[model samples]
Target chain A: MKQDSESIQKMMIILSKGTLENVYAAFVLANGARMEGINADVFFTFFGLEAIHKKKLEHLHVATVGNPAMHIPTMIGGLPGMEALATSMMKKEMEKIDMPDILEFLEILTASGVKLWACKLAMDMFHYKKEDLYEGVEDIITVGDFYNKSQGPGTHILFI
Target chain B: MERTIAGNTISLNEEGYMTNFSQWTEEVGKELATEAEINMTPRHWEVIKYLQKEHQDQVALSIRRIGKSGVVDIKEFYQLFPLAPLKTATKIAGIPKPASCI
Candidate 1:
């Protein structure tokens, strides 16, 4: 039946930015898929590796510079503490909406059975070892391995 | 819309969630669970009861809230209902579909 092909069975989200907004967007999408009875996987690469890095995950900041949505002048947005101010405000709003912190969200994703993968190339480029990644990460895999694991008729890949 | 469930005609929403909670019975829940392809255990009943209580008190339902509800954790909740636990469980509980995404 065409129904099988029309329905979304899996989501493969690739996160390539270290910004807090991007990381949360990827996490929420992956978690939302699982909540809807669909399988999901997140592949962290490039600057996104920071999201799974044990020591850096908690300190991610919203990108205020060059973000027109921030509504502040670019020069002002680039000032010291601007990103922190924006990040803190965003965090407060997220909490108001019952969104979990990055660490807790990772735990929830793991508990919800969303597989998390770290890119080998990015890990090596950043000199991050497996132990340096979040404990929930399933493995450090190459791009080819990620594509291989994510294959399916109804599977969709998204880059963020 | 009205549909027959467990031999009882029930009022339901467009998404098939029950519109009247009073019409719900354990038997209806059983049949709904069967339709959702879940075999009910005592554990499943417990979560349904918790959801019913929350709905009665007008508490919003979300995966995050359910995980923090102390009745069941997220992992076991997924295992219990297996697919779309919140929506399926709420449907069986005869409550309105939750608008929560988390």
Candidate 2:
């Protein structure tokens, strides 16, 4: 099916990981799409739900386990303080480039008209309440609803 | 490289975006638009003017922001530039590429 010029409007981004970099990248693209005159929505599911969790959003860490760049053994990633150290290092690097921290980035994205959605299934699995999410989450929705809302001509869906 | 239009020398980066906003003039904009194969119209000038003002303030320019700025709607903005509106419009406006576009 093809959409005529008028129907092409929205861009949907599915963020299924809570890694600091993944969330950052999603917002960057979402911001870009919105700036380009396209409506952009980001759906957070699975591990991605951590990105919207009130407390965790301020303290996200890169996943050293299974991360190709880590080079160290996966078992070492589980050691105490490893994640914290990694998180601090990432924050410092981002600061060097003037990139905002996670909390600030979310505010920027929302202010720019990027819609944020939380996956209902993931929320229940993680035992999170609506109050536990960040300020800009528009709704708690199922994957079906995500697909439903994403329907239209010229809709671009990306899984990150 | 540089293009001299109406006795003014405007330097462009390798990709052809203007390097100095001070050197921009309506004549320079027309020349740049011609090189991009875009016909200069009053509507086009509105977008270019808006972009130059925003650049001076260091505001991040986007299609939605420009549309909301009341200079022109998104549809008309796209119709005027047609391909890569932000990139093309910024280039012809003699401003740097918008951060979002990069």
Candidate 3:
């Protein structure tokens, strides 16, 4: 007989930067892993702190200005006589995708019970007070604190 | 899965923004509508709009070239798009069910 997940197998993650894609990737993976009954931990630090900044998460910006991906939409941003038609097409295409905004993504993770942590010393350097942190932060800990959690077999650590 | 929309069929890819929400929201939205007696609003539309643009931006768009960044404040979001009397806004917004509710 096989042991249940509660008896074996653990996965963990650490998020050190707060970019839309990075956070998205981390949570998506964690959520998927959890659905499969694995453990996951995301450690937020540095620029990554932006996602946990209560005042900022809702306002987190995607890298549209200089990023190559921004060009596709604008490629059709203003076409000649077909501009209106093109605009309509763009709007239509937009409706068919399922993307969670930053704030909502965080909500989903917390809602699903994925453990989230913040680096204490990093927060100290930025002079970030805990109250400034976003809702549902599990705890604030040092690198040593995170290492303690990352121990044991099957623990996975990732900086996204 | 592929779904048919207004006049065209939309393809669901693994990479699109709100890729998860866009694919499932309308179905859930419709279910919620029937159970709760509510309708979708424009603010829900805007947040998703921002999400789509940001998703495309993710492939390569950065603020320097795209010339725009930041999300609209959530409070003002309510004013522009009013909520359903029974708190339908949260449902359409894909707001996670509250902890207590779970």
Candidate 4:
């Protein structure tokens, strides 16, 4: 069949951190690509493992320390107790935009057909098994294998 | 370079879905523009149309086999739709997030 004169490009994203900062970033990109009808995949590994862990995925919180924008509150309200203020401030910022919490974001993305993977080496070292993963995981693979799938000319690899 | 409303108005029922464009106000366009995160300009309208159309199709994909379910790659987005909202648009559209990103 003849292709439409216009079509979206395919993209692949690999995630190495499972923290809220990393996972959410991947989802945001995935959702955006999906919105434009582009295909995306997120391969999770290393510390990123927490985002996919059935027990900890939802509770995947942001890293408050050393985060660039974490100082927004301190800048406004003076330097006292900025860490506490920053956490609350971050929550508010999230809501102002209505980016779904970790689990819901994943729900929507997975339902839409984005590929989720857990790294094999990370899983073994961490003593995690297939059962330790959430519902939609693709098989975990090494960096080399992950690269092959993401190797196509049109593919976009985002390391979040 | 401007076009007038042509003195037309549309009426919507209790539900927010759009009763008629003639009855729709600039506010409606503005709201849609904000929610969709696009400028709502003529330039974007064309891209939005393409996104909606591509989303509806069931064409086969050339994606690598990954998960057991073999997640399909929709492809052809960044190039075709530049101003397309990635994370931002999903919220406005009220669609679910992708699984991998989960």
Candidate 2 structure quality by residue, lDDT tens digits, B1-102: 887886899898998898998998888888889987799988888888888889889888765466568787655766787656788899998898876531
> Local error of candidate 4 at B82, Å?
18
- lDDT (10s digit) by residue, model 4, range A5-123: 35446667777885566777887888767655677788888888888788987666555565666544434444556545554566678755556667666766675567887888888
User: Where does model 1 exceed 4 Å of error?
Assistant: A1-3
How accurate locally is residue A157 in candidate 3, as Cα lDDT from 0 to 100?
71
lDDT of 2: 0.82
* Best-fitting candidate, scored by DockQ: 1
Q: Pick the candidate with the highest TM-score.
A: 1
**What is the C-alpha DockQ of each candidate?**
0.65, 0.13, 0.02, 0.10
The docking category that best describes candidate 4 is incorrect
Residue B88 error for model 4, in Å?
16
For candidate 2, report its TM-score: 0.67
Tens digits of lDDT, candidate 3, A40-120 = 678888878888889877654344333455464554433453444543454355334444556666665564456888889
Candidate 1 lDDT tens digits, A83-157? 999999999999999999999999999999999999999888889999999999999999999999888789999
Pairs of residues clashing in candidate 1:
none
Provide the lDDT at B95 for model 4: 25
TM-score of chain A of 4: 0.79
Between candidates 2 and 4, which one is better according to lDDT?
2
> What is residue A48's positional error in candidate 2, in angstroms?
1.0
